[model samples]
Target: MTSSEPTSTRRRLRRLWLPLAIGLVQVAGSYGAYRGQLERREPDALMVVLALIGPIALYWLRQRPVLVLTATTISTLTFMLLQYPYGPVILSFVISVFSAVIAGHRLAGWVAAAALYFGHVLGRIALGINEDGIYQSLAVGAWFVVMVIVAELVRNGRERSAAVARTRKQEELRRAGEERLRIAQELHDVVAHHISLINVQAGVALHLVDRQPEQAGTALAAIKEASKEALVELRSIVGVLRQSDESAPRQPVPGLERLEHLLSRTSGAGLEVYKTSAGLPHALPTSVDRAAFRIIQESLTNVVRHSGATKVGVHLQYGGTFFELWVDDDGNGVPETVVEGNGLVGMRERATALGGTMTTTRSPSGGFRVTAHFPLSAEDERDPD
Candidate 1:
């Protein structure tokens, strides 16, 4: 069988003490307020015992709110019918109503509380029991109304608390999803570019070692450089993912300044890349800079793997308010029905995330082409749909 949640000693005592106190007050203590007694000396012990039973039953009010209220109402009516002095057994019924309302059982609690109040009055009249006065009935009715108002207020408070908890949970999940995506994108960019260079250079080293030992040394040197860059980037990613206490200072994100390193690696892999610019080189915003680098890196990696091109032409132009980028080759172009892969998707996502656009198609020179544009003006973002 399953057990309840573990409760602290203090909490367990608090849970027990209320019902115990209510039961005690209803039993022996209620006799003091009663004008008549069963005998000359002592109060009616049987009546006291029945009153005690009503309040003692309130222990399950939270978990079984409806059942507890219904049972308390029945027991309270039974005691009243037995001609017992009123002993605040109604207190337990009131608490059960509040609990049931907050527990999302408002209709049942209201019905039970209403029945409890009317039932008590009906039982008193039907049994021909003497009540204190008309004023006593008013006081009892007002107290029942007060309990209902309190129950509604408790329900409102609980609903607001539950709504806040749900909002917090949703925000937590959203941030976690974004973090996972960021990590995946970073790892993909790092591994794809560096591993492509390393693979190509390793092949060059093996091929040239048997013929030209000098060319073999150059290939080995390129491999070392590529591996070192890969390790540095991988370590930075590890630092990014480490627990806060174990986290190291982060390396700066790759930007256009790293363009030279990318060009060198591709050059060493035997793909000559020609660069052209229409404007003076200038610093770019962090978002645009990183997106631009990843786009070019993925473009070149794809060219190496897919395009049987000997050379690539790269152009960068800054036309006052926007930056235009193009990477085209003179080799077998991509198929007409190009299936978009992760690299293509990542390039588009990076560009769009920075309020830019990217396109890929077969170039006029019978080679694949990647083109992207970035807006230098913040006006693009400020425009409303």
Candidate 2:
């Protein structure tokens, strides 16, 4: 069975103590006052016993409300019969009505209320006590109704507050995810171009180093310049996420025109990449361009981190309505358990948020493959009437 939570424990303690403490103090004080009224004569032993029992019954009010109320009513009625005061008994009845309201049992509370009122009528009539009759009963009944309504309203308001808190938490998570994607796009753009130039120059220096030492020196200088540029661009790319002002120059992020640059960066990372495109377009929406760029970047990052392969392949197809990206590495393949690193999970989240699908599988030659398909733009997604 589920145990009581902390809030419930506190509520239970409050419910148990309030009725017992208040009822006992009032009953004792009333008994003392009545005893003083008959000081010259000996007090009625039975009236004193009934007064004590009425308060003692309150200890069980929360655990057994009906039984405790029944015991209280019997003792209070007996005290009235013996000509003791009715005020203490009337106070106990009011407490019982309030307890029943908060306890969520309207039918039971109403029945208990009716019984207490009838007992009051009997005690008053039997002892011929001249006091306000119908007015007193109606006042007590109204108190019960008010307490029940307040309890219900409090319960509903708390539920509404909790629901609002849950929705706000979900919105926060979604916004955080979007921020991460934006940062990823910025990093991809900042690094791709300079790395492209680095790879081109590196290849030229390596090819010309022996043929002509003089020309090779110039080519090697170009390689050094290219590598330094690549590092500066990389630092600036990473600095976007930092609150620093050591800004480096930035270049426009490669769009469709810069797919070659993307390929160059992969080659500079010492991984040969082959890319094929079909039905290529001139440009894409910024969001789609950013997403596509990040997906390819993450795929290559994973290859560098996990895929022990010398060569990778990238394939892109633009169908106007949608586009596809495929990256495959001839690594020893993903592990059988398919546990995902943060980069892989981020790529999947991006694809899913854009209403795209990403699939990862092991290729036949012990390699890893990733494919993502995304819509071209929001305008492309709207249905025509």
Candidate 3:
């Protein structure tokens, strides 16, 4: 076993030692008290035997409370029958009560306590003991009541502590979930956007190589720059998933301001593209910016892969309540046979995580369109950036 395992086991053993020691000590002390009674010449052999048995049995009371308690009852009754003072054996009664509480049988414990109390009172009465003295009986009843109250209070305090620990654990889980979502958003933004641009630029370089060799070389150089930048950003974003000593990159991440460069790369790819925006460029939540960027990039990717049409359109509009994004391809719309893939599922998760919505639908003019509606305010509150 590992060193940690032994240390943990040792800790557990240490916790049990004190309680076990207390029980054994109490039993030994009771046995000594009984022997003292025997030396004083008031020795009832039955009382001595009963006293010895009661304390010894109490040591195992928690593990076998019912059996130990049965012994306790028999021993205490034997003492009383032989006309012995019950005061010296009172510790055995308290121990029995403690055992019952630990066993989660409070009613049985109380019943045992009551029986002990009444047995003493009734026996004393029968033996012509003073009936005017009820103080002793009252004292016995009070002691039992106090033990039960203390046991119940201890049980409740432990329950409250457990509830607090559970709440703290749930709060920790919620914070972790939020952190994962923030990282996912950053990955979709930084990696996907730059990768889409690189892919487009690479395609442009390939198409122009034969007709315009010099121009093809310029496109190739741009492609190299875009790919290298994309790889660096991708590595940085992926690093968030690692459990390492290094810190996350604190570089200023791209937002709407970088959209122009992103779109320029696509245009350089020789794809006809148009972009229109209505609102003044405003700072958006990192999640919203990431989501908006992803939706546009994925839509363009779908256009490149599936659509035969030459033109694509991207529209961004920000209102007081929400920010709207629309990407449309004037190509053959998505086929009914097209199965939803991980990319689509990822897009949906991103939208839902931000408390936003996205939909893919066929446009009226025989084209495919993607619409993403994001609640900018709701997202900004939790945006890590």
Which has the greatest TM-score?
A: 1
Model 1: colliding residue pairs: none
List candidate 1 stretches off by more than 4 Å: 1-15, 35-43, 80-83, 128-139, 244-247, 278-283, 319-322, 375-385
RMSD of each: 4.2, 9.7, 5.1
Q: Model 1 scores what on Cα lDDT?
A: 0.79
The models' CA-based lDDT, in order, is: 0.79, 0.67, 0.69
- Please give the lDDT score at residue 126 for candidate 1: 78
For every model in order, what is the number of clashing pairs?
0, 0, 0
Is candidate 2 or 3 superior in lDDT? 3
State the lDDT of candidate 3 residue by residue for 141-194, as single tens digits: 797688877866766677688899999999999998988876765565556555
For each candidate, give its TM-score against the true structure. 0.85, 0.48, 0.72
Model 3's C-alpha root-mean-square deviation from the true structure amounts to 5.1
Could you tell me which residue pairs clash in candidate 3? none
